[model samples]
Target: MAEPSPPSFPPGNYDLSSVDLDDDRYEVKQSAIRNKYTIRDSTGNVVLRGKQKMFKMKEEFPFVTDNGEDAFTVKAGGIMDVTGNYAITDTGTSEEVIILGEDFSLFVENWTIRDPDTGEALATIQSKSGFSRPSDTLSPL
Candidate 1:
């Protein structure tokens, strides 16, 4: 009897002419912008969520209110002390920003306001291009 042939793999000459490389071209474009600010207490509880604006120019970063009031300011080239927990979101870029406080308790205590979550200090809050506040002055997204 003739020897049985071994199993053969699929042929290499497959046709792929129907696949379109540029099919989904209308996806929403996202920009890189700092937009929203959310503060949480040490107990992992969210305390504050609002529209906080940051100004960054010439390597200096400062946190300000939506209407140009000083919320938090830091020196240029200095290390930023991020305390507690906070989240920042950029709607334009669809990026979720998170800041985790570290062992620098002294620095965080100095800048942040009273109240547990609010008491935590923020490090550098730099403003990227095309960042803006909403009309309601609540959240960035």
Candidate 2:
């Protein structure tokens, strides 16, 4: 008789392809100090987590997994960067993948998402004007 095979395991352990691209919704939980954030999928499964140290001159958020594996890192612009841009870097290569920056607009909140590698504009988020209040100025998708 042939020997029994070991139990099969899930493919792509912590691989990028293993991530569910279809699941867009994420449930977020933040610490009381707003320095730590826990992110979970819509099914209540922990997927990503982030932590930031307090009282830092420049903001840095290191996103990781529950088991303490580096996922990605986000470094915010210092006081000199007036546009309020943040760079998202890959954990392994430490290369900038995306550049997030805000656009200066009067009476509207505008944001621009770009690819740092190719310098291509990926998307733009613009808040509609005349919402009566700033809190409700977000434009519906």
Candidate 3:
């Protein structure tokens, strides 16, 4: 059987300009066996945050929403997993928004985020998930 279609937005796209990284603090152990990165905003508000699991061969970075309401995590092995409600506001009547990813090659599986009204996809932000190599591309998390 064919897979179900992804949900759609109402009319306009969700504006991500309001999204900004305020500030961040991280700690690395002497052994470098484990590391934690916590990001906060200018007002000390955590916008996006994550943790790293280091190993001899590879590392994994998993992040979640600051409020802990929703989670969007990425692994060092190129695995991205997103869950929970991502908030957005629009002046328009349409209650839908678009979640644009950094690239097309990124893979998303076992992920779900949607608009409460229509149960449609508001946005999907992930590149790839699973045991894979990391890319040189640099972009905000």
Judging by TM-score against the true structure, name the best candidate.
2
Query: Cα lDDT for residue 126, model 2?
Result: 57
| Model 2 lDDT at residue 63 | 84
* lDDT, candidates in the order shown: 0.30, 0.61, 0.38
Model 2, position 105: C-alpha lDDT score: 49
- What TM-score would each prediction reach against the true structure? 0.19, 0.58, 0.29
Q: Candidate 1 residues 1-141, lDDT tens each?
A: 984343332342211122111221111112235534443344444333333235433222333333443333222222222233333322333232223332332222222212222443424332222332332122222
Q: Estimate the overall C-alpha local distance difference test score of candidate 1.
A: 0.30
Where's the lowest-lDDT run of ten residues in candidate 2? 132-141
lDDT of 1 at 113: 18
Using lDDT as the measure, name the better of candidate 1 and candidate 2.
Answer: 2
Q: Whole-model lDDT for model 2 versus the true structure?
A: 0.61
